[model samples]
Target: GLSSCFHRSEGFMRGYPRVRGFYEVLSSCFHRSESPEGLEVYLHALQLLTTIHHGIQTLAVAGGTGQALWTFLCEVVCEDLCQPDDPPFVLQEQKGLLVHALAVLSVLYACQNQEAEHSEADTLLPLVGSMLRVLQYHREVSSGHGQKEKKEEEEEEKVDEQLQALIQTTVEFLSDIITHLTKDAVCELVTRGYLTEKTCLSAVGSLLPQFSPAVQHLVFMLSEADPQLADTVRKEFPVSLSPS
Candidate 1:
């Protein structure tokens, strides 16, 4: 439904009076502790809005709906889906919603970069924790599937598409965050209890090679600040811990 608007005209969503408070209406019904039956449909529609320039501009307008949307999404990701306490296999259960939520957040975050606006720790760090949790769990589930034969893997492709989307979404967003990481950002992750020694090992498992440099830089910053935590990470990932 929303995709139809994208091809039709610019500002269609913004100009549509009936669409006002659309997010609030949907969000109010989906509580943080619950995922009602059709939540993914709504989240997917919201995600469609991030696909076009005017749509991205509309949602990323900081100090307005962008800020509100960010807050609501952070809660959904950090609180509602793929929680640290959830098992990695849970990724299969939540992939559809996770992909949509992450896609929207990633676009909005990129928009903030153009404006040179920094996302608050509340909005960003917890989401980082959740995103890392997503990857770690995805890795766990993927490895769990390592025993699948070629035929089985091929047979599962239809079922695996949404899971693949979730992985791609989480990785892209994490890559963006890593690309723009800073000392203060690392500190916030630590201070907020988002990044710990166990998380350091697990989160880096799937992102090897491609994400090595940025992840190493992150650990190096950790060393400069929280040496003990850095030491734990270095011990766990000696290969990825090379000086960057």
Candidate 2:
């Protein structure tokens, strides 16, 4: 079925106007859907696009044909999917969709193409806060802080387990984006105070132990980009994270 869809949609690869039209159609499906099945189809469509060269270049990249989808993914899709209250099954499904979206955007930003006029920091700084919030929620819920009832604790534990992969995916996504940022962009992020030591500790320090070494290395690379912030991150996390 996916193969069939890809074959049929090849015309979308031609240029910006076609890409924008394609984006509008699928985004409409995503916006109109209230059911999980409905949401999944549109997400699947977006995922399918990532597999194609044009799908990514035309739709995912900044200043590409798919600015609408890019903005929607950043402003709404990610925010909604990061919520802790969704049903477990729904959350699991949303996790896959969000990861796909993140992959698209991360690749776009990392490429550093001249087509996009905006600085990577301009697009990425706001997302760091969203990413941190999701990570903090996962860390707090998984560790179990103030559960008075056994049932509630058990429920939280179950949600915590389901969320494990989601947390890892989110971390990997942010790590890739952070590691790819230009030196000047990272400096701007730090100088503006959008990325503080407290935020870094909350994201990197608290979650470092739980991450696989590869993901940890990626986060470590982010620290390496900024000496002062790196010192703060290293102090807070304090784990051996040598690059391979």
Candidate 3:
């Protein structure tokens, strides 16, 4: 029955006005969930559809259905998934859900941007703030500790691995949206004052070693534009710029 459910939703996503039906099904599934499994399946289905061309086209349509879906994702899904105040143990336990949620949101934002819906930017602003806060927490927890018992040390390692994975996912998500990052977007994020130098450094940690030229150039240009922000970013994590 569950397999049939997924198949039906998949088909719904492949046809006209697909997102509306898919979103309704996802909403219904999430509401009926008494356990994490329902939510997990919902996210899995969302992620799967996002990978399809038809799904992207479906999501790109700006309408009541699209708006509701995005709103629920930013408000409900992300809120429940990311708890910045949660300790490493809690976060480690929920890493799978968090990763899926972020990946889904990332794909949703990509589609939303394709539709050129500037109003959606307002909805996404808070999501970015939440992401930064979560990233900051993960960075703090993962940066090595002084002394602990053997079990504690092992647990810390597990947390570190999870946090690293999340950091990488968040970095890639931000990278996707960075191309259209306007001066206003930068100002809005800065004014929110939730983002700190540590957050920025953590955001880029997983991206630097790949030697992503576009990211490097973007950072270099940003540094030139805002030397103070550059100094703050470099204070802890010095990203070596490759000349090419």
Candidate 4:
């Protein structure tokens, strides 16, 4: 059981003072190891992090305890999880860790946005970049997989769906961030290659209905970045000089 496992693991139980630690000695072994052994420590930490994230998400859904999880997520993002160096692992393990971390952070931000009265765009922007980097890496791996199984239509569809979801979430987050940034920042976002034509179209289609004229103009500028996309937009959204 999870309770038993938690009780047996000191590092996992450290955050829970009420519980007696059973694995304290084994946990000390982690701290005693050298920097290279930190990878093993991180593997354990990731396990605990996964449990905490899921437990908090569940509590949030039940209206029990979400803030604790949110705080933990912030700490993990700032301190532990976003390491500069990738671990030396098999491809599968590396991919699994990346996907798990990205999924947890994505849910955390989405929940925070939904629960808060105002937007937390600043806090979320960097997260969007991080998630994009992970997704881009995943997409590259997936493209290779797709080529390897080019004739397998079902497998290709599964890969496409995963890629599409990543793209959609990225566009949504970027759109939200753009809404809070200056026009210059928004322009820089496009010029820096962070906002592509597909993302721009997605952002416009999703944000235009709710944003102000200024935001609409920014979206217009983004859409106009690509003439082909601009022409498509004009055709799809024909303007009328006269009032309806």
The number of the candidate with the highest lDDT is 1
How would you encode candidate 2's per-residue C-alpha lDDT over 84-110 as one tens digit per residue?
A: 344324443455566556655555555
Clashing pairs in model 2? Answer: none
What's each prediction's TM-score? 0.80, 0.60, 0.70, 0.38
For every candidate structure, what is the RMSD over all alpha carbons to the true structure, in angstroms? 3.9, 6.3, 5.0, 9.7
Sorted on lDDT, best first, the list reads: 1, 3, 2, 4
Error of 4 at 143 (Å): 4.2
| Runs in model 3 lying further than 4 Å from the true structure | 1-18, 28-34, 88-90, 118-121, 144-165, 211-227, 235-244
**Candidate 2: how many backbone clashes?**
0
Error of 3 at 13 (Å): 6.6
**Candidate with better lDDT, 1 vs 3:** 1
For residue 72, give model 2's deviation from the true position in Å: 2.1
- Among all candidates shown, the one with the greatest TM-score: 1
TM-score of 2: 0.60
Q: Which portions of model 1 show Cα errors greater than 4 Å?
A: 1-5, 11-20, 32-35, 113-118, 145-155, 231-244
Predicted candidate 3 versus true structure: per-residue lDDT over 26-139, tens digit per residue: 777767747677777676667666676666666667765556777877765446666555554445556666676777778767666544553355666677766665666566
Runs with alpha carbons beyond 4 Å of true place in candidate 2: 1-19, 29-37, 60-62, 77-97, 111-122, 145-165, 182-198, 205-232, 239-244
Clashes of each: 0, 0, 0, 0
